[model samples]
Target: MSVLSAAKKVFYLPIMIGEWDMATIVETVAAMRVLVAEARQAGKSIGFVPTMGALHAGHLALMQQAKKNCDIVVVSIFVNPTQFGPNEDFTAYPRTWAEDLAVCRSAGVDAVFHPPARELYPDGWGTWVEVTGVTDKLCGRSRPTHFRGVATVVTKLFNIVQPDQAFFGQKDAQQVIVLRKMVRDLNMVPEIVMVPIVRDEDGLAKSSRNAYLSSEQRQAALVLSQGLAKAREMAAAGEQEPAAIREAVLSHIQSAPQANVDYVELYSFPDLAEIAVLNQDVLLAVAVRFGATRLIDNIILTPSRT
Candidate 1:
């Protein structure tokens, strides 16, 4: 083979020849884009999962979903500074780089776009992306600027990686809602897909923040899932009032001595508008503080048959 042919072979071998053991890790936007361009040139469909990098089974699930749908899967592991509030755990957020890569490799992820915060933001960066209306409830009421940072960074990732479809867990239900709206409003090219939330055998939704929980807090954290499950039971038993469902969840969670409720809200899905009744699919979301650790979980409530 000629030299050019050999170079091309080396570049495309991972996807073209089905080498599946490792994921190519690129730390800068330029390097990541070069990989994306190579994949596009190879006539491959790309799937992306943007993550904060504490690789749980939840992250693995996203990768598996992507691999099933796209020829090339890229995962970004940036702990975005813009998304964290002043009192938030941004500095203390887990960054298990080697473990994260191993998990991705084990799941057959093709590329990992692990860019530093500086590369994405740069000096004197002033732009931000905000989705109105849907941004005022649930986790939004407390986190304030959280969704704006989420929107901005995710928009940047979508542009940089340019995948055919991007996957997100419904654990961050509102974030998914905000991003889907941004895609529709801005005419973004990639399809936004929401994967069902992944939970533990004990029912606590898997999260990077779970690492902060002490043994007691970890056990106490089960209250979040337990409360959500009770809400499902209520809905299944013909309880359709949003206030009643929210109250049921609140009372159940408050019974746990260590569980401090942030908010237990039921909102109309996708648009996130307040609803007096569950006329359609609605999101039942909860956020709680256990010691210094904060965890959020949600379930999508189906419409009442009664």
Candidate 2:
């Protein structure tokens, strides 16, 4: 066996030795493949969590959930360029490789698949995957090609990682739904798991982009969460129209001077379709700009029996 393969064997031995305490951290695709092979040899099930580095508590929550369900947990930390538009902050996106490694290590991630962009998508990469309808609302309306980029990269990741199950935070509710649809439509085999959104004590959804916020912008950004809260309150207290729920959310954000509304949408939860009445599972998704930083948040409301 090669030294890389040998190292993987040693790293994964604890898993087969009936010790679930061991976690492996790898930074390249080759290392991840070797680790996955070793885990498979050990008859261990695999779970995957993919992210664009700058790991936060929200990411840790996804990793923890994966740890609970799969014997081998793999996390990928590649800032996929295809997912970012030309005008977007791809250049400024946070990337703390060493810090992210430390975070993954502490989270008990079995292997970290940190592949370079070229390896994942070669120079001749012309093919792209697009999911219609779901990408037509909220951030999609603004980003246009954004969901296509997301779908293409995610499909590539799914092909490369081949995890038996994948974990995504519900904080990106539309993303979760888009991926689920992609897997189903394409007949991909991995089971997709959605974890609840992790938030700060003040209710702002934890995100890597939160670092871009200035002290004042950080405070202004809380309007996204507060707006969602207001929508939930209005919906629960006998507001049944979808427009009413959306208006409530918009009104709250409009109250904040720094919050520039990008979109405040009321759509069918997970389907991304517009809803006339607020019945069953519906998503209240919003995107707003505080200074130059764009942030998103959503709340899924089920109709109240009352």
Per TM-score, the best of the predicted structures is: 1
- Cand. 1 Cα-lDDT: 0.85
Model 2 Cα shift for residue 161 (angstroms): 1.4
Q: TM-score of model 2 relative to the true fold?
A: 0.91
| Residues 1-306, model 2: lDDT tens digits | 432354455433232223333335454555566666666777788899999999999999999999999987888888988888878999999989777877777787767777777778778889999998688878788888888988998888877678899999988888899899999999999998999999999999999999999999999888889988888888778789988778878988888899898989888877877688877788888888998989988899888779
TM-score for every candidate vs. truth? 0.92, 0.91
Candidate 1 residue 89 C-alpha distance from true site, Å? 0.6
lDDT per model, in order? 0.85, 0.82
Error of 1 at 72 (Å): 0.5
